[model samples]
Target chain A: MRGAGNRYVFWAVALAAALAAPLALTNNYQLGVAHQALIFALLATGYNLLLGFTGLVSFGHIALFAIGAYASAILVVTFGAPFLVGVGAAAIIAGLVGVVIAMPALRIKGHYLTLLTLALGEVIRLLIRSMESLTHGSQGFSGIPRPEIFGMSFRAGVPLYYLLLFALVLGVAFVWRIEATRYGRAFKAVRDSEIGAEVCGVRTDHVKVLAFGVSAVFAGVAGSLYAHTMRFISPEFFSLGLTITLLAMVLIGGRGTVIGPIVGAILLISLPEWLRFVKDYYLILFGLAIWLCAIALPDGLAGAAARLLQARNSVRGRASLRT
Target chain B: MVELLSVRDVGKTFGGLKALDGVSFGLAKGEVLGLVGPNGSGKSTMINVLSGVYRPDGGDVRLDGRSLVGAKPSAIAAAGLSRTFQNLQIFGGLSVRENVLVGRDCRLRSGMLGGVFGLGGSLREEREAKSLAADLLEKVGLARFVDAPPSMLSYGQRRLLEVARALAADPKVLMLDEPCAGQSQAEADALAVLIRALAKTGIAVIVIEHNMRFVMNLVDRIVALNFGRKIAEGTPEAIRGDEAVIEAYLGRRGHAERR
Candidate 1:
């Protein structure tokens, strides 16, 4: 197992590199894509708490994302709330909804739970489309005011980038801290064997609900950031396709590892843009690539990297023993 | 010693078939009792009912005189009962030490927010839990495999890991379901020694097994069951001489020959 100190150093270096990205990439469009990738990373990391650690597969995460966006948007636009209040409300609302979904989901699992979440995502999307008075329906919510932090407007460009980057770092660190606790062990235990977890004194239902709620909080925060960054929102933005992409990010990056989802988000987000040369066929190629990765690396990219690292460490230990 | 766990007229049924029929037993503190029976004789079902996996159809299960009839498995576990499954229930993905850490979760006082934030108290508790897990692993002779996953351990080692995990709970009543089913004779002997040592620590033990020799040699007393009914109960020596137990195990001819 990786020590706490090593994990801290790894995150610190990664955060520093993220902070320095703007200096090298001066293009506004690239920065925008980078910011979106970071948001997706936050979403993926949160989703992994359920999918990877807790062994839950939710197809309704996009519903949580939509709920977060709509809740924050409604709070700021309709209620004229402060930006920070909107951000906090977004997370709280999504987490509450997560608990509601978890009540039924926890009672049933596997394919049944997946179908339930799928229906939930569709229901949320349809609800948003039908509520034209609040969400402006298909016309979408526009002119969402830029967030202000102590008189500094984060409307676009580097300031907005840094604001999102900070949130992502905090989100990652929060999850990392959770992984080091007894509660974290409970989540893993439940994932491995519900009966074993129960006999070991873990309340499996509570653990599952907490996993869903925490995962939704991450998506909510990401959604809030997305709303402010785009200065617009639409029901179309939170589609079942978006949920599938997030699932792909977690699976390809390697589930159950702290760095896996982030790695997955970055690669999946950038892969499409890099393949733009192929134009219309790029999506098909992307799908094929994901398929290949799934088949070739059953443990995902992170698991492969972990195995390689272990191999290298053992070799070094053997060489030292020879001396 | 006072009774630590009590089962009175407990019964369980699946559809039309009775799995356990009005079974009654009391386990005193520091006592080691063996539950032996043929296949489908309700030994495992009794463990399940007592552990709260199954609610007894008719009767009561109590820990220290408090009824645990309708409680959940986790609640029963919190009430100071820990059990191992007949087929290994080890977490295959987690390290051996991590598995023991999970067992200590019930006794830990930190809440979800505190754990997520890594508050000073929570961090200290985690550190203490890790050390305790290490100690338990050492007791079970699995200290060298602390960092290894369950998949890496041999079958016998995994069995010991399960016992170590249950012991980590510091339970008042420990239940072992067929713990020596597939073990080598040597491994089974080691496990016997460990179980006896655990009982000496003042914890009541219930060993459910089909291995007659192993159970007979390890337990102070024995309870025999056949077709969901108790056939006999007595000291290990008395159980060996009991005509009903002989009939239950061997056949009607074995009882006739004794007569």
Candidate 2:
């Protein structure tokens, strides 16, 4: 298939599937899990822009996610702002913070950079905790109102699912568009060789900072959705474990490709719940699965799938030529 | 007749060691200059300084009479100076075409908003860049491997790809550090043809190499360095026959004994 035509078909199918999900799963609990998965998918898609394309490992993404969530909650619940304003604020605030963090974090790379971002994550958490009057400290925030647009409350169930689904589609489309542009090529170039990129006339520093800011915007938007959906916000929700899980999502999905993180997010989000019957062994199995993904499938499930599809197509093309 | 690039008494020091000291050379438009020296004689350092990878501690670099001192690599590149590294700096993960497309990045005007929105201006620019990348790959004789990753390319091919990528910047001055390193004689000859062709287009080409035969045949003029200082500068034949040049290549005692 031609690239553009195939892409349109893929989007159509993905859209139909997403729209039909609520009807197919009827159960509110399943829809809720799906909703959470969509939010995570959005986060992973954004995070992949930095990790997969730009080759920056950041453990501080969870902080951006937290900022978005807290920003939305504080604006909506405390100030009685409209849900849309809160969401927009969340995205802008997170993006600005991302730029600030990246200014220092991008100076160092590899293990040292990773360690720096880790410290940054802890710092954001500490700041939030210490601002007791504003954030209620470790006790967290609750009673976050459901998102409303034109007086239609998306409190739960199908409405929330559809809303999250729409956001996920927009997020995926946004990332897909970026991947096809010159900026995407620059990101990949910087990731591949910073020196080469510099020689090629790319300001790698600017590109890195832009990538961080863009990635934060995605996380922030997802976090806003997550806050409204969950109707609660807390520091614990953005813990180190959440960061690790997001890292796993990107890794397990495949780093550079569009569908990789979404696939990883969906599978990892639902996997533990499906294995809940196994009780204590579920966590152990989940850990082992991630390890196996790292070792056995170095490119992750999406990458593996892409390779398989390419092989099949080539084989078919060869067969037709022989005939 | 116009000088495209001039290096004036440039100096660089790292701790106790002087990497480049008072190195000066001028390159004219449509000229091919060879910079040759033994390992660690500051050949690569000179290229780095010229390309803005290292800031000169003293003196200045000028392109078309504009000072390039203390400019960042990207800024230098934008000012029409582009270089390939001694160690291949190709984007290993990107395809051959994409590698060259990155070279046109400095010329591109589209930003994040344009990219996200896929506006007409950005799309048109992207189409032009892709075609330019394709044209550059063809010029370097790597069109057939346009989709292949750098990892799949041979060392010589990677070197050629690096040249193609650098050329995509459409630089006025192109510095290639050991471009023919580790290549077969035939491969080196192909590179020589490409260098001559690029120079004919009025680019000031600087080829840095230890391969005497390759550089001797490729460049119109030669500059020889030893211990971070120029020992000879003249026609390739003149430099090849100069006693200092011979001594720099061979030891002074060895050359004296031969004499």
Encode model 2's per-residue lDDT on B1-259: one tens digit a residue: 5678988998999898888889898999999999988888899989988888888899989999999998989999999998888888888768888889889889999988887897759989998989999998898888899887777788988898989889988999999998887778888888899899888889989989878888888899998888888888999889878988777777779766767
* Stretches > 4 Å off in candidate 2: A1-8, A313-323, B256-259
Q: What lDDT tens digits, residue by residue, belong to model 1 across residues A216-265? A: 99989888888888889999989988989999999999999889999999
List runs of model 1 lying over 4 Å from the truth: A1-9, A315-323, B255-259
Q: What is the lDDT of candidate 2?
A: 0.89
Whole-model lDDT values for every prediction? 0.88, 0.89
The CAPRI-style docking tier of model 1 reads medium
- TM-score of candidate 2 chain A against the true chain A: 0.96
Residue A91 lDDT in candidate 2: 100
How good is the docking of model 2, by CAPRI class?
A: medium
